[model samples]
Target chain A: MDRATLELKKSRAFLCLECGKCTAICPISRFNNSYSPRRLLADGLFYGADNLITNPLLWSCLTCQLCSQRCPVDVKFSEYMRDIRAEACRQNQWGNASHGGALHHIMEMAAAPALKQNRTGWISDNLKVKSKGEVLYFVGCLPYHHDFFAKDFDYAPLTAAVDTVKILNHLGIEPVVLDNERCCGHDLYWLGQLEKFDELGRLNLKEIEQTGAKLVVTSCPECALALKRLYAERLGGVNFTVKHISELVAENIDKFEFSEVPLKVTFQDPCRLGRYLGVYDQPRQAIMAIPGIEMQEMPHSRRGAICCGTTNWMNCDAVSKQIQHSRLTEAKATGAQTLVTACPKCQIHFRCSQCGDESQKVDINITDFVNIVASALEG
Target chain B: MAGKVSKTKKKTAKAKFVPNIVAFACNWCSYAGADTAGINRVQYSPNFRVIRTMCSGRVTPGHVLKALKLGADGVLVSGCHFGDCHYIFGNYKAVEQFDRTKALVKTLGLDERRIRLEWVSAAEGTRWGEVIDEFVAQITTLGPSPLNHKPKSRK
Candidate 1:
């Protein structure tokens, strides 16, 4: 271990008290025994990095921050794990098929001509505006990774995104979509591949800057969070504000009116959007602005909301499924007719889990919160 | 015979050295308790040196080690009892952390007994004095630290 890393561990060890609260409450631990925040601190303190760096448990964390909240001493155990993982990557101690392996797979897919042909190829027919617009909508890796645009609801995901451009145009806001938008490097950073993260962040930042847009709007919460927090602070000099589409639509609710559709809707707070970035009210306000859509809340909504378990940061499908099942059970218990979430990951996770239910199944709507408000428009 | 007796008495006087103690008192509970002790004019040994922190959670292991390394014979960590932390549940974390540090000190062959953790509420002025008096007497009997003896090479 480096001197600085040792000193940090020493300092952190003083804060941690081996209170097994983190390990007990973690949602991922239902599947993987190796992922324990308490164990990580103890190992770091007593045994040092010889055990921590190579352990597969480090990357398995959902970064849901449940541990940090439960900690009595304010040890900041979750951030410590992140720092440890980051250090492991810094020292080139990563194993094969790391957390970012899926991201690498997706990046490879992006390079394929067949994959690139359909990905992000769809745009509004009426978008005759030039490539340079005041706002840029970064669709992120989801529309490409999940083939979301091609699958489901009459190609509505991509079309709605295009329609979003039209909606923005109607609001006197012409937004540009990057023809070659790459993954926002959140996956790489979360995976502890700092080198890849740096390379990808620089590449994405360069491409985004070329559009000359003053503001960037994203439908993906992860992409929005990464761009707004990580990219803004780390890769400075990119003078732009990153807003989620729901935030943007909520800002312009005066321009849209609801038709009183009499739908009971409940919103699931995406981990990145709500807990990580403090975006609770914007989506709710947008949803409530729709006249007849009564918004009910789950017990664990907003800050304390459960993870949807389909984080792009980790490749643990087994753990993700376990988390998904738990969250879906809670969502169904809320007695709401329709379940709406902001993140594409949350939508994908919930949809995958909801497929097996045969009876008393709640209708799962994967539409962006903004799309709902946009649909409510009288135009 | 008288000259020999005088020389031996001088040597005994030189050997009778008292230990220096540092005590950490919380602003809410322990500090007020100490103030109560003073107001009541409860006479105790002036061996203890008290430093005030906002809460018991702020009493880090580093503070303990730093005090010991800087020639404090004993360290007294006093705070509000469990569920009494003004910040709520901070003392639990503090106690847990202190226990682990105590274990580390034991492994290093240092006198972990010299370091004491106590919960003294504002009303527990008598308990505070009793704790300090007992620690001072105990440390005075234990004498100076082994760290002052000689540095050992484990390698």
Candidate 2:
């Protein structure tokens, strides 16, 4: 390390005693033995950009905060890696090639009015939906982008969401449809593309503002949290309210009834919507309100919930898989007939990993909370 | 008359030797603290140039790098204390970025002494002055960044 660089690490190293607790509990290390948090920190402190930019391990972190949670001194190894990744980006080093380019492509698509305005078209014609209302449903990109490539993934949820809008219509809660709704920009920010995030945020805010819709509901937890949190910086002068569709449905629980489906269900909390954004109770309340359904808790629930490995924002393939496997195993151990999650990303990732393995045999039913609520409504 | 004459001459020399410092104060805390300093007349170095931002977390590593790259002799980043942020932990995020960038800067052979992080609450205007005084003195001792070592190739 250069003298100046060493001088800086002196402080960082002073605070970080190299206890290796970060490496010990790291979920990434469980799958890929090649990943060493101790080495990454040492390289960062000793080698600077040389090791960080060149090492494939630097980009292999899922940033699930598992290490941060376990660290005794709060060293924040994952965030340190994020800085290294940011520097790599600045130097034109394409660390994770798979999803990095796709982020830019998605941003371009999100900005186009033609594409954004037709977002609701992803729903089938058989799903009866009305156009004007005070509530607007923002169905996020996963179901639209991946289609049936995900396992046990049903587009029937899209119909259910439309059915939710119809139920609201029946209740005299006129919901306005922002057919021009693009992404709420969670992916762009998570992908480390702040500029693209700003553009997408502006577009979404503009479209949402045009609707004059007081209540914004979305099927995606990531989008809900992003709209509620991230846009405060991006659109300083604009203000609006956002709610997950489940939260909306939970608020209106008395208006609906369940047919007592015999299936025990465990709910998966999306990271952005849960720990990262602090939306835990609303989703759970919605799940529990369903009559005759036994609610099961995953070993890791709420703020401690692990992210699905397929976060377009992060590029830690090895660690993400490790987390996915752990979460799937835990959810399966609950003996719930189905594993349910609110985010489309979560739905898609779990489906991809299921792959019909007999040992890991468990039925995965990926459905949004609103879909369940809409279906349970006593027509 | 002789004592008055000597004091005026000393003041002029002290003013000429004081380092000129520029600060990018986040709007939430540091900027309000500077305003507090002005209201309280804390008398810090007039050397600082404060640019206000909504949150200190908004300060990207690129901004700090560019400021140093663009010839700011010394940079001071002040934000709400950890957990006290108006946006709740935005400054903590800034803390993470700064920790790495500060480390990165020293690695690139830059003077690590020229950049620092300080937490100044909206009520701590005098603390802001004290921080500026310390930063200005440190930069004065170190001189301009060595990154300015090379002349523009195009020029």
Candidate 3:
């Protein structure tokens, strides 16, 4: 192993004791026997990356971080997978995009400093947002999703984006909504396109600084994580505060009016929100504050929540759908009318899973938590 | 290509002859108006599925587009009369969102006439009934929504 690879192995992967605990808890491993985190690590440690990188199973990992959670030896298989993915992307060897790289191309284009996107044109006039405020709401690739997934997914994507602003408005805070907001480069960083991710981070930080917002807020956990954690690590330290919408909503949960619709609902914690950022209670606290509403527990709730599956627009195979189908079945079994999720990707993936094959349909409504709060707000 | 063709075939086979209407009724006025219409026993089309939001401004382009994509033959958004919004300017936002949603749908080549936004106040029970009758008549004439035959992505 190279020095960088060896350092990662020593600090993380080398500690693996081959307990198979990660594989046991893995959602993909359960369905697809050919790909196992433990076996992948074993192969890497035994034969090395040169041999293992050629294996197609390398792309199949969801990187949901369940293995690290259950691993007795604290081997972060997801991070390891991310590192491997980055290397493969550098070599131009990666899985196919389900959308023919349209989304990836958009992200790649966003890395440029001169690209002026007409992306924010979709911001409806009803939203009371500005280019400068004390708070900056980093609108990520949501506009792209708005256009791309329009035919397949509901206005759920755009609804989450707009409701996020509306909820901020309800909180008496008019967010600095940047029309020139660039992608957070989360997809790039995770896909191993590190320099492109750094450029985007630099570009967004420059734009956000011009607004002079003291706090940065976003509905997308991926963007929030990238802003709060990765930007500081890979680029430089961000001077401002970055918070997911749920955190801010939980802080102001007492101020909102609650509604009587969908009295009982369950929350699907996104892997980034739940595991990456440790934001579990904020979503629930906001949910439970609504009058006559109850938050149901999915069999896997909080830290144990199942991932919506599919990652970085790569390796979206049958296992992704099976994972989503299992999670939705679990959600429906809870008898909750709606499954309130904090991440738009979760809603999109869950909805996409339900789109194909009517047999996979479960009788539960999938919605963003911000939408729920926005809908339930009385005044 | 095979999957796409099969999907189209399946959609046409189980088509609903009746229009599937999704209505966004504002809470303070239009929703109350709907209640009054029910209380008065005013007959209207049974195809309408009403979702009550606090204000019409709460209805975004996504909601209307989603409704249409989910096979809604028509989406009717009713709220407090202009300048009469319970929240002062919510109806205006609804109007803004309605126009934007309509534009986006038309740009996508879907029929713009499938969506209608109106003002129905709390005391407008008769008006509520008439609106439904009119929207149903309009949708029936427009035939089923292009989205109606498409597969539903929501679970």
Candidate 4:
């Protein structure tokens, strides 16, 4: 059998019962009737891999793993989609990349072996950090996002990194911050550029190993997922343990002394942190630790959480806008003053969805969960 | 003995590198500026290649970075002066894009001088020639781009 067929067998796509559970729950399938995970599996099974590979709908899968979570027979639909995308990438078939693929090119540039990145300029004098230590804070692509989004968006992306370090310092842990760190390659891996992703992974792993860090903490859930899971699964394995900032904060919630902010906030569970890494509760726990804070849970929370409209910055269209609009409306409906997210991309996408379109605008303040924790820290 | 001397001289000459610059010139201004320079017979460095774009804003960061990644020693984005843009505010957009592109380029460890944004009008033919000559010279001094190398064979 061909490799694509083998992937289908390995991911248990053949065991699909045509239950349409995946389709019914899919955020994309709700707005886009043409996209269905079950139908894609059936097409691969009956019509063969070629039909499945060439189909444009193949790129439409968000790979958010919502389907796999709902699948009874344990069919890893998102993993199946990832494998197929790798095949498609090998054939030079790229999806309609948003932002004219500028973000992808940035990742590729970061993958260059000889690159001497000056990525750590955001480290302010106030935050305590070390050049090498046992705990390394992986500040991934936040600086780039800060530069790229500075013009239009009022949101400061780098504040998440700064706030993370502040929270770490408050916990009496001065984490190592590397100056020459490459991207974590989460986007590249999802986009099926496995070769570049591997290159980036190897480079990042070498840098982290040099720091002698036993624990890797990241504010961005995508970076955390890549370092913790994708690196272990794809690039042999890493020496250090990876933790999302939420996990670290949650583990030491008792150590923190927070000021009374008295704000009602709702959490957006990033798919990578929630489903991919099973880190649903830690972020909520950390948020609740803030004094005088009221935590309102969205209707679709934890495993059932809807994705933040898009993934890997691909296939962003009207459906993505609608999903974002609906998600924002849901956050606003809970009577929360702020919609706090654990992921920077979530904050960016939600803010981006509110731009330009007056009719689709949902009035809500979006922020990173770390920013809240930092703000609530008692000096 | 004479051949050895000649070989040493050849090595020294090879050290005098000619930079490969990929210039994105806007059609309304910079591209026509180049034409105006040619009409005026102004002399400039011939090492740069010009790719005419509809507007300087058309040259996204992806384009500039792709050129460098594919072995461009330097990239020059030339557009209309502020308030002189044919598209009203296309040059303003170009400035914004250029700022972001420069930041990314710096983050990637390339010399920020290797990538530049300049305002040149069609009437400023001599200025166009001067920009090219100066940018090419600057890139040469900075040496070849670190990203300049053969594409690695994928595993």
Measured by TM-score, the strongest candidate is 4
Q: Which scores greater on DockQ, model 1 or model 4?
A: 4
Q: lDDT by residue for model 3 over A35-111, one digit each (tens)?
A: 88889888777766555556788778777787788888788787777677666766678676655454565565565
lDDT of each: 0.70, 0.66, 0.80, 0.89
Worst 10 residues of 1 chain A by lDDT: A108-117
Question: Which of candidates 2 and 3 is the stronger one according to DockQ?
Answer: 3
- Candidates 2 and 4 compared by TM-score, better number: 4
Candidate with top DockQ is 4
TM-scores for candidates 1 onward, in order: 0.62, 0.60, 0.70, 0.94
- What tens-digit string does per-residue lDDT give for candidate 4 at B85-149? 99999998898888889988877778999999999999999999999999988998999888878
Q: How many clashes in each candidate?
A: 0, 7, 1, 0
lDDT of 4 by residue, A45-140 (tens): 887766777788888888889888899998998888888888888888888888877888888888888888888888888889998899999999
| Displacement of the residue A153 alpha carbon in candidate 2, Å | 5.6
Task: Give the alpha carbon lDDT tens digit for every residue of A64-154 in model 2.
Answer: 6666666677766645665565556656665564432433344444554433233455455544444654667666664334322321334
Interface RMSD of the predictions, in order shown? 25.7, 18.3, 11.8, 1.1
Ranking by lDDT: 4, 3, 1, 2
Q: Alpha-carbon error at B38 in model 4, in Å?
A: 4.2
